[model samples]
Target: MIDALYVAETGLQAGQKHIDTISNNMANLNTTAYKKGRIEFRDLVVGREVTSLDETGKRDLVSIGNGTQISRVWKEFQSGDLKATENPLDLAIRGGGFFEVLLENGEVAYTRNGAMKVDEDGYLGTLTGYRFSDMIQIPPDAKELEISQDGTVTAYFDNDSLEIGQIQLAGFMNAQGLDSIGQGIYVANDESGNAIYSDAGENGIGILQQGYLESSNVDLVKELVELVTAQRGYQACSHVIRAADEIMQITNDLRG
Candidate 1:
């Protein structure tokens, strides 16, 4: 009876985790270049045959099955839809790539978000203030900025255009392994492999589309269906717990 209760508890926990993941995805539906998260589960088994030696030498065997557990939570890196924003500073990639951003701690992070803006210091950066990893700077007096599909940055000033610098994209062997820090940013870890820098349209990187941004890849309909399933699963687990408790109570009452 107690084992049944434990199994049900595990089921309840797993259901809750699934619901939480879906909830987060729904919350970020409108976030630029946002990727959805998924949860994986593993089964747990308890009770197995074990040999024990008594003072007089003895052998014993036992077998037990526990329940399920959450094995991993990973993000799906499927490319999101690119929408035209008509903003010169907005950018989007149509393939597998991420923009490299330099963090305040001198470390670097990666993101698919391309909503960039130039600051008073002539440094181009993301809305969150993280500058591009490369030294792509703009002139203080530049009237227009253009980023080519190949990542060439051009500045127009006084009826003249000049190439400033080039923006680069980073790729990973296992992007799903990257650690997500909020705000649609991720940091590479050993599991994700080191960052591979390349031109936007070179080395398997994606082509850049100026005046556009990537929309979150979350599918609202699918998430809503999954949310409902998770809720039902949670309720079923609770029912199991109730049944187990009733059995335990009946067993206790028999001793009266």
Candidate 2:
């Protein structure tokens, strides 16, 4: 009966976690460079003893019972598709790489968002006006803008003046080690290792597409399927707990 109660509790908790992930993905369906998350469950029914004593003096061996635990939430790094919107400032990656942007705090951060806009200072930046690491300044009289697959930024001015800039993309050894800073920005950590330099469209890094934006990688159909499975698992666990309770009640009535 006790085991049944613990199982039911863990199952309900896991179901709640799944719901949280689903809601988060749905909320970010329209967010650029958004990655979906998945829940992992680990069965930890045994616990090891932390302390040891003299074998003859005392028995320190202990195995405390534990139930299901949320192992970890994993993020999918699959690249999102690029959709052209005719916006010259828009950028998208065709592979697995991130754009380096300068946050308001003057720190260099990474992002996958390509729906960028220039600020009043003529600085090419995100919609939030945060500057990009490699500023691709457009001439005041520029009329045409183009970005090559190799991260080359070209601007054609009215007077035949052209300016070119190259934006470098960065990747990490362990992408999961990067911490999300909201708005699709990420800060690298020890687990993430250092950013590996790579030319766009070369190697495994993704190519850059000008006038395009990357959509969120979340798949609604996949999330729905997981939601249903979680719900059913919760129901099954509840049934087990209910049956155990019924048996316990009958035993008690017979004893009375």
What lDDT would each prediction earn against the true structure? 0.92, 0.82
Q: Pull out the clashing pairs in model 2.
A: 95-206
Give the Å error, residue 23, model 1.
0.7
Can you tell me which runs of candidate 1 are displaced by over 4 Å?
50-63
Q: What tens digits encode model 2's per-residue C-alpha lDDT throughout 49-128?
A: 55666657664656655557688886788887778798888999998988888977898888888878877877788887
Give the C-alpha miss distance for residue 227 in model 1, angstroms.
1.0
TM-score of 2: 0.85
Residue 226, model 2, lDDT = 76
lDDT of 1 by residue, 1-256 (tens): 8888989999999999999999999999999999999999998976665667656675555656688999999999999999998999999998999999999999999999999988668798999999998868898888999999989999999879999999999999999999999898999999999999889888888899999999999999999999999999999999999999999999999997
Number of the predicted model whose lDDT against the real structure is largest = 1
Clashes per model (N, Cα, C within 3 A): 5, 1
- Among these predictions, the greatest TM-score belongs to 1
TM-score of each: 0.94, 0.85
- Tell me the lDDT of candidate 1: 0.92
